[model samples]
Target chain A: EDQVTQSPEALRLQEGESSSLNCSYTVSGLRGLFWYRQDPGKGPEFLFTLYSAGEEKEKERLKATLTKKESFLHITAPKPEDSATYLCAVQPGQGAQKLVFGQGTRLTINP
Target chain B: GAGVSQTPSNKVTEKGKYVELRCDPISGHTALYWYRQSLGQGPEFLIYFQGTGAADDSGLPNDRFFAVRPEGSVSTLKIQRTERGDSAVYLCASRMNSNTGELFFGEGSRLTVL
Candidate 1:
């Protein structure tokens, strides 16, 4: 079975604090790794997609990096507006469009 | 529409009743997906459609859960004999292409089975 595990189920950070969320996975063959940010009462917003080890993508204060067995979403100088649940999902090569998601890490940035 | 849209933002029904949730994908998007999310958990894939055909429905929990996308642009998820365990947020997403790996999601429909 393809499984994804995210650590630090919940994290509280001061405004401008930096931290990284972890997503570890075990799959037959990883086709893609995805990161998303979801606010309360709203759908998840797409953040980044990492397809290969050593790949990294960034947008604004967020940076996502991938390794052979895990991925990290680094939040730099986060603000209160960045507080949200960060989700991680993995798609196996065999499963065309299926995504196995982690429980997610709820991040709170207190100003 | 500019983004994926789902109807019936919130629905509350008695157990054993039937319910239908709808999703409208973005214009020109050929791949549509359905997922269910519980509190404090990530979205779980339920089905996937490419055009008018269901390419994958393996994630569906059981036969009581059925989804259709006849016209390819709009889709409906029907749940028979709704149970309290079925209460969750049903999310719909779309991608311009299957290989893109990036999916745009709708606001989601919250279902409460009483």
Candidate 2:
């Protein structure tokens, strides 16, 4: 089965702290990996997509990178508004259009 | 609206009642998806639709769950004989038919079965 696992189920960081959330996957083919941020009582918002190992993408205070077996979402100088559950999902190369998601990492940035 | 939209921000129903959740995809998005999210867990895929046909419905747990996208622009998920276990936030997402692989999600509908 294609599986995605995220580490550090819950993380607490001081404002302006920097840290990274990890998402490891075991899949037959690597198509694209996605990162999203979800707030309480709301749906997830898309962040970035990593398609290959050694590929990295950045937006504002968030950066996402992918490896052969895993992906990382790095937050630099996070603020209270950045507090949310970060989700990672993997889409295989078969054009299935279905995503296998990890149990998200709930991040809290304290001011 | 420019983003995906779901109706009835909150729904409360009895255990045996039937319920339907609606989703309006962003204009021109041909791929629509439905997912269920429980507390402390990731979203679980329920179904996927490309145009008016269902591309995948394998994630549905039982026969009581059904969905339709007759017109291809909006979709509805129907659940019969709802159980307390069915309570969760139902999310809807849509993406362009092209291979950008980016999904835009809505503010999910919270369902509570009593």
Best by DockQ: 1
Scored against the native two-chain complex, candidate 2 gets a DockQ of 0.74
What is candidate 1's CAPRI-style docking category based on DockQ?
high
TM-score of each: 0.97, 0.98
Predicted candidate 1 versus true structure: per-residue lDDT over B1-114, tens digit per residue: 799999999999999999999999999999999999999999999999999999999989999999999998999999999999999999999998776668899999999999
Off by over 4 Å in 2: none
* B-chain TM-scores per prediction: 0.98, 0.97
* Top lDDT model: 1
> Pairs clashing in candidate 1?
none
TM-score of chain A of each: 0.98, 0.97
Clash pairs for candidate 2? none
For residues B1-114, write the lDDT of model 2, one tens digit per residue: 899999988999999999999999999999999999999999999999999999999999999999999999999999999999999999999999835578999999999999
CAPRI verdict (incorrect, acceptable, medium, high) for model 2: medium
lDDT, candidate 1, residue B75?
97
